[model samples]
Target: MSRHFYSCPLRWSDMDAFGHVNNAVFISYLEEARIDFMFRLAPGDGSPSFSGGSVVARHEIDYKRPLVHRHEPVTIESWVTKINAASLTIAYEIKDEGQVYVRASTVVVPYDLAAGRPRRITEEERMYLLKYLDDDATGTNKSAEDAEDKDALAA
Candidate 1:
């Protein structure tokens, strides 16, 4: 599976007194990338696609390093880690200059606006998400084992 990458610009206000991007701000970056990916994959034209918006059920983030303000945009790579009957998990990495600053995942459920409840993923939606399934455990880029090996050697 190929990962979708989004280049997100950093704002000066994203920095905190500690001289690095605030931890909470990382959520915004992830949200932006997810939104962009969703819109691109399923436009708002009310097509048979997954046009129904989704709601985030959970978010988990691991901060690997602090991100300092820089002129270049931060790159967020995202891919579908798992897809279920009603929800899907998206894994993400925020990186710059080949260094990962954050690793995160979000659980999102398809929402029915008028019904004010969650709905099962449609067949079309499931098929669309299948194209992004990253079953290798290593993700869309490197393998998890390779990353662990590198970390172990570095330590």
Candidate 2:
């Protein structure tokens, strides 16, 4: 599995009074990288690919260093850590230059747009996502099967 890296510019408004990028801005960068990765794997109709509305279940961020206002370009890299029928976890490492400045993980759960519930991910999507999954990730595809099986049993 290989990670997808996206290059995004640090907006002028992204800075704060401290002369560094705001904390919330980092999540925005993560969102952009995640969206870019998903678009690469699955091109949708200009909406999120996850079935159910793809709500964020968890977000954890660790800032190793601060990004100043003068950085040239920032690179945000993301890859699947685990994929499940109802939820998917993507890990991100955001950097400027060759040094890592932030490490984060987001757990996004699938939601049924029509049924208004968590939905099981399709096998095609699961397969498409595997190409972008992290090599160090353990049991990425296998976790998805359990959610799928549970959904099957429920139905």
- Pairs clashing within candidate 1: none
Stretches > 4 Å off in candidate 1: 44-48, 137-155
Best by the lDDT measure = 1
Query: Candidate 1: lDDT of 5?
Result: 91
Cα lDDT computed for each candidate against the true fold: 0.84, 0.76
For all predictions, the C-alpha RMSD in Å is 2.7, 11.5
Clashes by residue pair, model 2: 52-111, 52-112
- lDDT per residue as tens, model 2, 1-155: 78788997888899999999999999999988887776664445643455335678899997767787764778888888898766788888887666667778898876777887777777767887888777768523446545644664586
Among the numbered candidates, top TM-score falls to 1
RMSD of 1: 2.7
